[model samples]
Target: MLHSLDADLAVIDPEYQLRRAARVDNELIYLTRTGGGGARFARRIRRAREEVRTVCGVCGRPGIPRTRSRTVLCDLHWHPLTAVEKAFALSADIPEAWFTDEAEIKNDAYVARSAADQRKESANHLSERDMADLLGVTVQRVHEMFEQELLAGANHDGRVVYPRWQVMEGGRLLPHLPVVLRAADGIEARTLQAIMENVDEDLEGATPAQWLAHGGCVEPVLQTLDQWWWI
Candidate 1:
């Protein structure tokens, strides 16, 4: 699908690599990528424009469409930000021509949103409660792991404070979140601790490679738990 943009010169291939080029005309510009159903895709997207009265980007709420250039985000869930606001947040300057077209605007929005998500993720240091939620276990289990040296955490205000890295590291120890061990309702806190301790003990004699082998299931397990609404 991407080849079409290059064929049309809609993308610049400065290095002779088939890259989609940005197109500008009059007061409008667009970022084009090849995606369509023959000649039918454009028709469908156009029909969507007419038929889709409103789409809220954040909470998925329905609302009236406002055609202002920067007003693309669903008003209910997202605060519309000016291009300057985006530039400041991303620490990058955006070209003025890019804002002239709806498609380019959408692409810029995507890039800005991704940067925001990355910033949030980097700052999200998990607490004990966060780890408990991630593991589908109890706060007590985190404490137990600490006591057994299978997990490392700090004591803050007499409460166990777990950093996000610790949870990710612990996920390395047990790839899957403890959904099965959690039972239909939930596993007792002590039971969770004992299970982790046992798992850690079993791998004590194993190599780092063996540790990594078991760790690959973490993402899949997270997916399964999310599917089950266990996470």
Candidate 2:
């Protein structure tokens, strides 16, 4: 019976074939035939259509195909700046044709979003007095720590503001705060803040601040910073 069905299917679809017959319990049985040639081609076309019709990665809405790789993105998330904008934003010379590469555009989008997130996080800053109170030390002691490079801060609107992540509850700094500060010495405060806030793949997706908070080793973190030329 299976042979009869297989012969009929082969005649109807020239690209289709069936094989692999076996005997089981003295009964003739056939192995499931794989989808080949025309059937497989049809399946691939269907899958490509599905991929093109999938939802956007950034938003839940249905996406329009945006790249040769068929990445789907909505209008809001599909915004790619021109080469001039990219060059200005990245402070580097970039060719207009560079944006034609989908990978480069995706990377630029990721970097832009990361920078925006870091900027938002950095807005939560602590003044010297606030830092001193949080650490249970005098304001002058906070200044001394900054001068000694034991802590880091940035000037905001004529007032110095420290990143709140540097200090923990119960008047203690992060366990590896000094080590990170020393390694990150001479790097700008904004860059250092971004490094601390960004998730490190080596640390299993934990931010530097979270890793140190949970008693992670500092050597690995320092090594990562060193590789980035931050040390």
Q: What is the lDDT of residue 37 in candidate 1?
A: 28
* Residues 78-102, model 1: lDDT tens digits: 5445767756644654344433466
TM-score of 2: 0.47
lDDT of each: 0.39, 0.61
Candidate 1 residue-wise lDDT at 182:
38
Deviation (Å) of 193 in candidate 1: 22
Question: RMSD in angstroms, candidate 2?
Answer: 22.1
True-vs-predicted CA distance for residue 66, candidate 2, Å: 35
Judging by lDDT against the true structure, name the best candidate: 2
What overall lDDT, based on C-alpha atoms, would model 1 receive against the true structure? 0.39
After superposition, candidate 2 runs with Cα above 4 Å error? 1-123, 229-231
